[model samples]
Target: MKRQPKGTRIRLLLAAFAAATPVAYGFFWSEVRGRGTPDGSSIEVRVPEGATSLEVAGVLAAEGFIFRPRVFDAYVRLKGQGRQLKAGRYEIPRGASYSYLLKVLQTGSVVTTPLTIPEGLRVPQVAERLAAYVGDSTATVLAWLTDPKRIGELGVPGPTIEGYLFPETYRFAEGVGIPVIVRAMVGRYKAFWGTEERARAAALGLDEREIVTLASIVEKEVRWGEERPVVAGVYWNRLERDMLLQADPTVQYALGEPRARLLYRGIDSVADHPYNTYTQPGLPPGPIASPGAASLHAALHPADHDYIFFVARNDGSHEFSRTLREHNNARNRIRLARESAER
Candidate 1:
């Protein structure tokens, strides 16, 4: 066989090397693509809205969530997740594989903070709790809640979204805006106010706003689940008889702050405020606190009783009475029991 020219042989070797380059690259990529960086710490990565895959990869790499931005971008594209990456604040774990991190971003598994708004919390209280969770101040959340336009947009028929901020446990994405938080709570209230609940309110000759107001009062009055409807019935009876509600919660609310215990002087003094149900002939202008679903239901469907009064038994329950004499007797009995216990 004739020997090839040295230059031709050299060209052949170069061609062979070029042809094997992609295979070598494939082996190297496989080895590193699935391997996680040796950092066992967590880092937060924020992908802004409308960010491209390349931009997201850069953010992750810069944040130390990944070792190679270009490799991440290529992997995302290969997995058809280039357009699926969601915009949010994500807590990327250290040593997470590219695939795992990509999945987290694509699925929008953003970090969330849990916030629980308990029953009978006023808007201000709720705002304070929300501020602690979302890094917004109570004033900021209150401003968002009290904005008439925002309240109107939420379909809450009031000057403020007081009763419309449904009390429930919520998980919010980190760095969520105030409007988004308010809207979420109000939206939950709207959703809970189903057609049946609305119909019940109409049947009771009360609008949605009135029902919510009464429910809030009932929520503040009773802590026992079974006592809600009975307490609601007492209030309904008082309203029907044109009698004073004399709800202590209303007095506390009118004081513009929470009190560990309501004094008789405070109750008497708050009678001048419009929210003073003891002096005001009708329901207050709006809900004093956020009522849960149970309280709302109780307001719409009060127990069928002639109870016009109720006094707490100091046991997370109340004693109902149909007549003033009976109510006074119950109060005296409660006082005596307390005195006896102290002795």
Candidate 2:
């Protein structure tokens, strides 16, 4: 038997270690960090544009989608794929290993689902849209929005979450929770209301929530930004004069059901509901809809006008009048215009 030199044996062992390192990494990555699952099931993980490597790792780890972020980092750094990880959205498997996650990101397998939440939707309507977007039940969203405890948990200083949910288009991955979506919208609303609006609302003897309530009525009443101030003025005038606002939106809210059209008889008959401005003689108990910035500003600083009645013209504008006679005339003209347009 020939004895190998000590130096030669050491060199051979070093070479073997070098060769085994990558294989060990691959196997460990599969077992602990998620390399490959036999089922090939995929999941979606968003790495948002402009996220740092650390941020990407933290998000994945926090979401429990990845078991070993360091392994992912190391592999990406070695492969020079760290810089190749594009932002936007990605679909990853539930038990995806770190290596698989890195590969998915490097290959730009991000998925983005467009979420369009229209303007002027109430909580229930918005919830319905959200559920449809995530393929969840609308009731799930309502359960969160309507939960007073949930509102408190969000740190919103309000009794309800009605006026705080800002309406806008969102890009959400599939299977997001209702609370997460609501929190995102509420956070946007908080940012919007954080500036001069809060102070202004306080000075006007209105709380932030009350201002939102009034803004909501203005939102439903006025279609044009320029008209919002005037519409707000009319409601303020009614509040000052001790006259019933008799806003259609308030009556609609009182009805507790959504309808495309409202009848005079319905307004006259809907009784004892707090949101009926015609009966309550002031702003409704809460917001009628989630108002935008323009409506909110208009509510805070209404135009100086005594005009009490506004009828929607055939065009997307309103006919403002100071007296019942004038209001009736405008209404008649609107009716005539509608008749003409139908013909």
Candidate 3:
């Protein structure tokens, strides 16, 4: 072989260097900021609360997000984003890169399920509503709800946290615990009572618990906000007069089974029960169900009216009366109207 000139050797070395530089630069850029082509298939993964970057990287590795977790961990920490990892259920694509995964975790764009708890549902019903998200059996969720220690921990004054869980549409993280869900609901309840609400409660000569109890009955009796205050006033008048509330909803609560209508025999059946307000002279031992904000406000601010009785007409509205004779006439009219409609 002939010996080459030193200048020619130097030129060849520089050319090789120039070629390798772009390749290395491209690889570095891809590792730092590029995303992989997403495949259609994805797996669900959960990053636990307070999870470190290395632990999250390990989870991704085991779930097949990446082949090398240490490299990914190093990538996360070196970028000063270790503490930015959020905890929640996530949908990870099979072909995603470390950069993409970090982006998902950093942005905290986790999967959330919207849960709407309607007003007037019992605690057991609320527990059933939470069954799909809590990964527990309905019985287990109920047990969690009725747990004495948990109720005391939550500062609930009621026997079972019945009325404290505010009914609303809540976006809960997928795979969240039952305690977390209940806490969120109770938190909403706490936020609902500002100074104005508390003052109204005091002026009405009622505590939050008593107001919730009455509000629950009002919630069950009426379908519209316009009727809430009037219904509440009927009960308030009965309470003031030392009269039996005779609220059919309270008897229904005692019966525990949903009936299309509460007949006289049904009321007589639970006459001994405290929740049977047709027999009991005052509010029941506790709330029968969760009350909405309007119902709560109505309980605090009942309508000032002399009406002492109300009967549900065939329509959604009710016919209220101030005297027994008037109430009887209204009842007969409602009965005749119903019979006519049936005919």
Q: Among these predicted structures, which one has the highest TM-score?
A: 1
Poorly placed runs, candidate 2 (over 4 Å): 1-111
lDDT of 2 at 226: 94
| Deviation in Å, model 1, residue 38 alpha carbon | 12
State the lDDT at 279 in candidate 2: 75
lDDT of 1 by residue, 51-155 (tens): 989999888778766666777786676566789999998887777777788789888999897888898888788889987887778898788777678765877
Q: Assess each prediction's global lDDT (C-alpha) against the native.
A: 0.83, 0.76, 0.85
Which stretch of 10 consecutive residues in model 1 shows the poorest summed lDDT? 27-36
Which of candidates 1 and 2 is the stronger one according to TM-score?
A: 1
Instruction: Output the TM-score of candidate 2.
Output: 0.70
Each candidate structure's TM-score, on Cα atoms with residue i matched to residue i, is: 0.82, 0.70, 0.81
Q: Which of candidates 1 and 2 is the stronger one according to lDDT? A: 1
- Residues 12-120, candidate 3, lDDT per residue (tens digit)? 6546755879775455446544244566878898999999998998888788777566667867875668899999899888778676788899999898889999999
Q: Per TM-score, what order, best first?
A: 1, 3, 2
